[model samples]
Target: MNAADAWKLACGNLSNSESWWEKVIQAYQEPCRHYHNVAFLDRKFKLLDELGTASDMNAVILAIIFQYYEYDPQDRASTNNLAHFQEFASTNDLPQGLRSKVEALLTGNEDDLEKNANGENDVQLLQDLDMSFLGLVSDAFLDIIKLERKEYDFMSDEAYNAMRRKALQTFLLIPNIFLTNVCRDRFEAQARANIEAEVQSLGK
Candidate 1:
């Protein structure tokens, strides 16, 4: 994966890096190289231009996770989305070393899930719940960004919807949120849809 993709993966796995790693190993057979891509640099500059070096890591993580729902790792992406997440996070004005930690987590989790699932040990279901919660946080920000872009002059609804779709997906992935002011004030409906769909999906 490229730098942008690495950052994206990192953000998607922001909390509970081990979970991200487990899924990543499931997606690809082997690990790839190190180094952030060029676009990552550009992303950082663009973010700094806007947020001026104090960009919210939570919001930024949400944004990257939003991108995660667009592509299916079941395809020929070579590796899982960890690379993509890292790419986006490193280049943008988000936190440093977060991507690295996530990568490490991904590497280590190669056997944890299977062992736990196979009854090798009891599972901390709450930790899994937190991963889902992160996705909900991702989705909440997606709709908010859509609404904000609409407020930005000359932005089209078409583009905004695309963004919203991605956010909704990330939100659906974890399907949980601790609670944020903007989440309740806005994006409540979309969040509900994500939760219901995820629940129904698991039921089936």
Candidate 2:
């Protein structure tokens, strides 16, 4: 489904305003964004159907829509995306419970991964979906790598390679890169292989 249809489905019975949709589109289309664009959202929306279930499908969709709303290669610590999403939720008069769930998913922290591994399913599904790109077949995975590298074009090769290697290594060190059983079964081995290959390429 397209993002607009997915947004409507997610907003079910809530106020789905054109202005809000326009803002989301604008954010993703920002010039600095390469990987985190409408195409990315469409990919996630497609994958959402394959993921088993979420406690709140609405919140998951919302989280996917807004997760990178405020991305900046220069500001890795920026929380503006979450802040903006909260503001959007409040403005749309969405239920507090739903907003909270979406916030937790968007946070995408290690704690959420732990909860997923411990049997809490919602966050696990969301996180697995986020990392699904890593598990793509070799050619497709390399294509995403090129797009991601464009996002950090400002960085010198040495700096970008060092940072990228560290991030990829962290995934390798994780006992299970994909938290959910389904993802582990489907993508874990290939994801690890892809990351290892990318890390080697970065080193050279």
Task: Tell me the TM-score of each prediction against the true structure.
Answer: 0.24, 0.90
lDDT of 2 at 73: 81
Instruction: Please provide the root mean square deviation of candidate 1 (C-alpha atoms, Å).
Output: 14.8
The model with the greatest TM-score is: 2
State each candidate's clash count: 31, 0
For model 2, the stretches where C-alpha displacement exceeds 4 angstroms are 108-118
Give me the displacement of residue 60 in model 1, in angstroms: 1.9
The global Cα lDDT (0 to 1) of model 1 is 0.38
> Residues 42-142, candidate 2, lDDT per residue (tens digit)?
88888777664566778788988888877888877964778888888888898887787788877754353224434666677878888999999999999
Name the lDDT value of residue 114 in candidate 2: 28
Model 1 stretches astray by more than 4 angstroms: 1-55, 58-70, 73-79, 85-178, 189-204
Q: Candidate 2: give the clashing pairs.
A: none
